[model samples]
Target: FFWDRGGEALFAVNHLARRIIEAKTPKETEKSNNPKDTLAQEGLGILIDINGFQKKHIENIHAIAYMMAERARYFKSNIEIDPMPAFERRIVHEFLSDVADLKTESQGEGLSRRVVIKYIGAI
Candidate 1:
């Protein structure tokens, strides 16, 4: 079965998140009966609000990497992100692959799998 034709699913998530945040929906607060299953069906992960008004697909690799880099630099230690789907994790890994002072790794198994960002040196 084909999932997410082109990048529509990701765009859908972004749109949905925006609507939810804007209170465009009615007061009933209609929520998906099975949020996870619904996202799976769309071949998408989660959607998170960036800043205050913008909603971004969880596959937002650059944002994730930047946050990781910031955390690692601030704490001077490895930073671990919450579990993400394989495709999303791959995005993070690939984006950080060329950074000289940062290293990335995927750890855990199944749904618990997540990404770890390590500070290798000053950049």
Candidate 2:
């Protein structure tokens, strides 16, 4: 049996979010679908729009998130020259094109490691 390509399936949520914003599609709700429910409520859209992003352009956000995550996983550990920070900076530049203000930090003991990035008012 094949393990299957999980990345495409994983991106479905992002695509739905993209559709909700009408960037990908604007198909209305079906009979079984509730109007009250929306992509914003699903909470999978944590990777939000940086700036100048309307309801559309959701796919750009997802693409950035995927790139960031892929670059994030390349780090071996804190002691081994973590590349997460540099990668995050690049992501910020890609989204903003102007000055970039982002930082990536990793802190943990043993195998329970964590990586996080935040903006420092860079635009």
Q: Which pairs clash (backbone N, Cα, C closer than 3 Å) in model 2? A: none
Per-residue C-alpha lDDT of model 1 across residues 20-56, encoded as one tens digit per residue = 6445332334445665444434434345443422234
lDDT of 1 at 86: 72
Task: Determine which window of 10 residues in candidate 1 has minimal summed lDDT.
Answer: 50-59
lDDT, candidate 2, 1-123, per-residue tens: 111362333345545665666543223342225444454344324333324232234455436554654444444221222333332333433553432444455555544443444444424
Give TM-scores for every candidate, taking all chains together and pairing residue i with residue i: 0.52, 0.23
